[model samples]
Target: MNCEEATKLLDGYLDGELDPITSQQIEQHLRDCRT
Candidate 1:
């Protein structure tokens, strides 16, 4: 997914609402975007 999509999922992830797959994707995105 793109940055916006990843960002949208971030909140749910922080709150532990996302599934494993989605949470993993979001984590990967965060790592990639972290400079």
Candidate 2:
């Protein structure tokens, strides 16, 4: 996911509301992304 999408999902992710696939995507993005 891009920064915008990831930003929007942050709350859900922190609250454990996102599905595994989405969580994985976010995690991957965070790992590979550089500002």
Candidates in order have lDDT scores of 0.84, 0.95
- lDDT of each residue in 1-35, candidate 2, tens digit only: 89999999999999999999999999998999896
Best by TM-score: 2
Colliding residue pairs in candidate 1 = none
Which residue pairs in model 2 clash with each other?
A: none
C-alpha lDDT (0 to 100) for residue 7 of candidate 2: 95
Q: Residues 1-35, candidate 1, lDDT per residue (tens digit)?
A: 66899878888989999999999888887778854
TM-score of each candidate?
A: 0.76, 0.92
What RMSD does model 2 have? Answer: 0.5
Worst 10 residues of 2 by lDDT: 26-35
Q: Which one is best on lDDT?
A: 2
